[model samples]
Target: MEQEGEVPHVLIFPFPAQGHVNSMLKLAELLSLSGLRITFLNIHRIHQKLTLHSDILSRFSRFPNFQFRTITDGLTPQNRTLGMFSDLIRRLNSITKPLLTQMLLSGELGPNPTCIILDGLFNFIVDVDAQPKIPVFSFRTISACSFWAYSFVPMLIEDGQLPIKGEEDMDRMIDGVTGMENVLRCRDLPSFCRLKDPSDPALQHGVTQTIQSLKAHSLIFNTFEDLEGPILSCLRRRCPNIYAIGPLHSLLKSRLSGEESSLGSESFNNLWEVDRSCLAETVSQMVNDVMENKRNELMGSVNETAKLAKTSVEEGGSSFRDLERMISDIRFLYRRQREAIH
Candidate 1:
């Protein structure tokens, strides 16, 4: 337990993938800026790749409470690809689970985390140390629609929705997913769900992980209430404690800009170098098409949505307020844990 006045410390463990690490790292930076202590855990290879490719180290160097730690994933870089994801998960459960347990119980990492912001992809295991009762908040890097659809995989299979007969059935409605019945189609389900076999390992693994997400104390999404209101409503029926305080990257900019906090240029933690060569021509052609051919058809809806997005992340917006609530809730947990100990 932390001393009476010590700041709340949060440990962030993102799945060692580019998209997962990128979003969670932004959240980590956001929390550290808000005066919370943060310990970001990464696999050895991802950490090295991040350090070598991005200014991730110097970016968070100003925050004394921010730290980075790593453990082995038991795989070489050549072995870590989309095809080997199942092997990676198995290895993490077998090899990395012990190290994580030790870090929690032995205090080898620093202060015991007031809470853990975990990657939803690794929801297969939630047994962090049981003694102290650490709260875990599952963060899914994907959109709520995508996660909601994944959660219904088992239901879809039981209802004979899987083994989608043929390309002829591609446009068939996917009624199994609650709020998205009208919008979701067989072709729209994730690529893995398109397989001829319903019992495919990857598909089953996805279903298991998504179903296990409900085991977390709460769920966090990288979206805003205004954007996914119906889907969010469906999710709340299952897990009520959810924080939709995103588009995180934009919200972070809004918060920092409002506070007049001058954090340097935006930094990206991509595992591979970004190729910008085609962007110039792409942007010029896009602008030309939008101005000439798409003007009447697209301008109104585009402008309206852009305006909503702007308002959603500004002061008192749904996302901004939810972010404040999330921070407050973490501190509340810290105080409650301390009181229980006393």
Candidate 2:
């Protein structure tokens, strides 16, 4: 529990993936802007990569309330770049699970975290016994559409829509997932869903992990209402407490101004070397298509989407309001905890 007049503290734990760290770090920065204490947890390898690739340490250090901590992900340097995510998940559950238990029990990370924003992939953390009973928000790095699609993997398996039969089945329309029945095809499901056997361990593990997302007290996604309203609606039916306050990279910029607003890009957090050999040609062609082509309708669409994105993060917009509500709710959670303790 927080002491009198102490700022609310949030612990942000991201799965050791590029996308997960990028979005969660953005969220951590956003929360830091609200004068909250933020402790960002990173796996040791990813932390080293981020430090090597970016001025992340110097940049974040400017925020007095923000800090980073690293833990071993239970993988040797050799096995760290494991082939499949499911294999990594299995290792993390078996190895890192006890580490998390120790971290929480020690209370040495910081003040008892008023709230915890965990990568949705790590829903297993819910099983850890942390005495203070913190409110955990499952933050998914993917779009609302992807998360919604993932939630229905079990149904897809049961309906015989998965174990996607052959090349012919690639174009097969999928009706197992509600709200996306018409829009989704077999080929559109995530790559892991293309397995030849329904009983594949990897496939089953993915379903189990995605299903476990529901166990979180709330869900946070890096998307805005304008982008995925219908799918967000479907998601809300299952997880009533959700915050779709994102395009976090953009939203953070919209909420800040001047040099203080300077934040790192996705590449800054990337673990692997980026290939820029063909960048010049790619940009040249893209610029030609957008600006020079007489028949290009893409420019108009791009402009329209950009305008919508800007509006969504400005005052009185859906994302801006959602972000405020999310912050307020987290503060409320802290208050409720304090009240219960007293």
In order, candidate lDDTs are 0.84, 0.80
Residue runs of model 2 more than 4 Å from their true location after superposition: 1-5, 82-84, 128-132, 258-267, 272-282, 286-295
Write down the worst ten-residue block by lDDT for model 2. 258-267
Provide the TM-score for each candidate, comma-separated.
Answer: 0.91, 0.90
* lDDT per residue (tens digit) for residues 170-273 in model 2: 77788867888678987787877888887787777767767777767889988888888999999989999988887788888866654444453332556666
RMSD in angstroms, candidate 2? 3.0
Cα lDDT, model 2, residue 220: 91
Over 1-342, each residue of candidate 1 has an lDDT whose tens digit, in order, gives 344348898889999888999999989988887889899999998998999888888888998888999988888778977789889988988889877887788998798789989899996544844634888999999899999988888888889888577666688888867777689998887888877787787787888778778767889999988788889889999998999988888877776664543464566787777677778888888897768966766888777766777788898998888888999999999888879889
> Candidate 2 — which pairs collide?
none
